[model samples]
Target chain A: MEFYQRDRTLQPAGYTPIYKTSVARSPRQAMLSLQGSLSETTGPVFGQNELGPLDNDLIRNYAKDGDPIGERIIVHGRVLDENNRPVPHTLVEFWQANAGGRYRHKKDTYLAPIDPNFGGCGRALTDENGYYFFRTIKPGPYPWRNYVNSWRPAHIHFSVFGSGFAQRLITQMYFEGDPLIKECPIVHVIPDEDAINRLIAPIDLNGSIPLDTIAYKFDIVLRGRRSTLFENRLEGN
Target chain B: MVQSLDYLKETASQTAGPYVHIGLIPKQAGFDIFENNFTNIMADENTRGERIIIEGRVIDGTGTPLRDALLEIWQANSDGRYNHELDRQKQGQIDERFRGWGRAGTDFDTAVYRFETIKPGVVSGRNGLDMAPHINFWIVARGINIGLNTRMYFADEQEANATDPVLNLIEQTERRKTLIANRDDSGPVPVYRFDIVLQGENETVFFDV
Candidate 1:
């Protein structure tokens, strides 16, 4: 996996304090795509499955262009406490999709494209209520050597929260029956089909909202009595 | 529309009497770490056994649904005092009268991560200024990390607002919208709705600090 960083000497100084968003003195804008009517608000929309993580340290970024595997699809979701309450100001982080349908963040790499527009990774902080969301396109499947002439299903890799090294999860969201599932080597790793269903998000087509502007809602729970079978199989990092 | 708050009148609108205590309860990390960090956290000495709730939702740019994020809040008491080491050191040097500083931790899994603490106090300003009474928020969701350094100004405080040093630092265009606190629609948690709009078209106010 290839990791890249940005330059700071090039940062122009002025009203934008340049350190923290709160202290930005000039040209302060909301980081999301806010589109809506009078009372309601609709936030940001990045490029096709294209957006980088919204870290407070926007000054720095990790590039994925030089990596061997490529589909840089940025996958995102939310995390809530058990009580069905919004914890409001929480942090969410995930890095997947390289462009050629591969991951550049290490751990998982199936060889995909390295999209320039799609940073292949993105990040967003949840609002007041524990509602965390992201703007990225669903990732496509890549062909692997699970079996001769076999390809993986269309899926987006995911991880939850920023407990640093102590907390990091690796799972993939597969679209409904994609035929390739029959032979994908990775999918075969999980012997049980019922278990895979848990991670597979039900298809909720964004018809009225087009793929370019589709909305997928996926929530994650860190630790609680209601544990998913997936966690039972693997431990998050 | 250049309007100021009605201070005394705004204070009149608030439910007066006993001010409450709040605490910070965060989930620890590591295996077997699943043990509730709250049990011992809520019982900490600083919190004084007072239960205060902070609640709100997490949403996206398109007004769509989002879930599974962690949030943290740290601020001063209703009297505008903090329990931090720095605040303690500056006590007499800064503003001997205001204690303004403390931190609380909580998570919102079902669409909202709320905190419970008595509303903070608007600390008297140093070098001739007034500090806004608001809590600082921090969030971490599936692979995202964000921070918002803002204060929840009471909707009613017209006078104190006008002279607020920090609030004044914000541009006139973003000031009004940012300096607001909404009432909680749910149960009587003394809710004040404060939403943070990330970068994009129309965004909420962001600080320069």
Candidate 2:
């Protein structure tokens, strides 16, 4: 029942004022660290039965007349622990703007027209090998109100649930060659270049469909469980 | 296990953004796509315990409620047992009907999130001491770069709350009140109001676990 401690240095600070929202939302007091209790060690599980047959296929899940207009691509990756162990059967959810850089959301006032055929959302479950793949259109970079000329890089939002509640993570995946990744204030939150590099998905020609779609590989790593032996459970395993 | 490579570093996080609803809860964003959608209802008629409703708003420094905020809660059953695999093996039995987890997005007009659940019993701490009844909460929203974690303790449980190991960890005794949820028994079902302040004089105590 032992779990590895989270590395605080790897995580972004709460008060990155350049992000604008941090000015009003960042806490003034320092956070308190605690050992993982039962609440933190356990999380809700989503089974295969809970998902639909087309849940992992964004290309056709919500398509009406024709496939969404854009560069068809496959986003494939593995869910692993910090210890490099495969985290199987975890739920991974994704959402993004269309290739035109316009979200279906009503609040998005971006001038880019919304693709009527694109829903821009999908879900997938990792296999025993912790592998998952989804078909989607390449999202377009878009503008935001962070600053006068603040524009987000082409990215996809991902929500992942590991075995433990403490392992729950929500992040954005950027393209490897996207230059905007270096300029976005949000991406600059992490001080380490290596940490930021892990978020970028590299092109995987080996995984690409010959005539149909290109493929990008983005593997996510969650907090790991330590190999410590618990005195009370030594006989159990 | 054959060790081939070093453990990979955990990936950096980004904001959920203004359009988080499109993926996390697509049904609320005008698309009824998910077959099994999660709601604030974690308990049913057969679930044993005192039924209660937890309601609150996430207020910012300017005293404005965040309309885009989303919250998820996880707690033990009324019997003080979690539905998790480890807890199930240790506790032996739990109310299977009690899902013990719920997700709720703030209302567009009201900016309040509510959860219908049964009051949880005392759970054991790491040292095997009795911990006060509380619910673990995880929050994220448009402006939040990383999800925040906090807990809600019942105000009525004074005796147990006084000795709570977790609550006592807060050096500032006055700031501990931020974690307490006030109870209103005037209604049919007891309602506990716990407003989480992200930044202000009454900012809630967030945890780094």
Q: Which candidate is the best by TM-score?
A: 2
lDDT of each: 0.38, 0.87
Evaluate every candidate with DockQ and list the scores.
Answer: 0.02, 0.56
Could you give candidate 2's per-residue lDDT for residues A52-83 as a string of tens digits? 89888888888889999999999999999988
Assess the local accuracy of residue A172 in candidate 2 as a C-alpha lDDT between 0 and 100. 93
Indicate which candidate wins on DockQ.
2
> Tens-digit lDDT track for model 1 on A1-237?
000111112212212221221122122453222111100110111111222333311112332353223322223345543333343444444433433565433224444444444444434556655565554545566654423565657655443332211112234456555676565544433434544454455544542245334444555543211223443322111
Candidate maximizing lDDT: 2
Sort candidate 2 into its docking category: medium
Model 1 chain A is weakest, by summed lDDT over 10 consecutive residues, at A35-44
RMSD of 1: 22.3
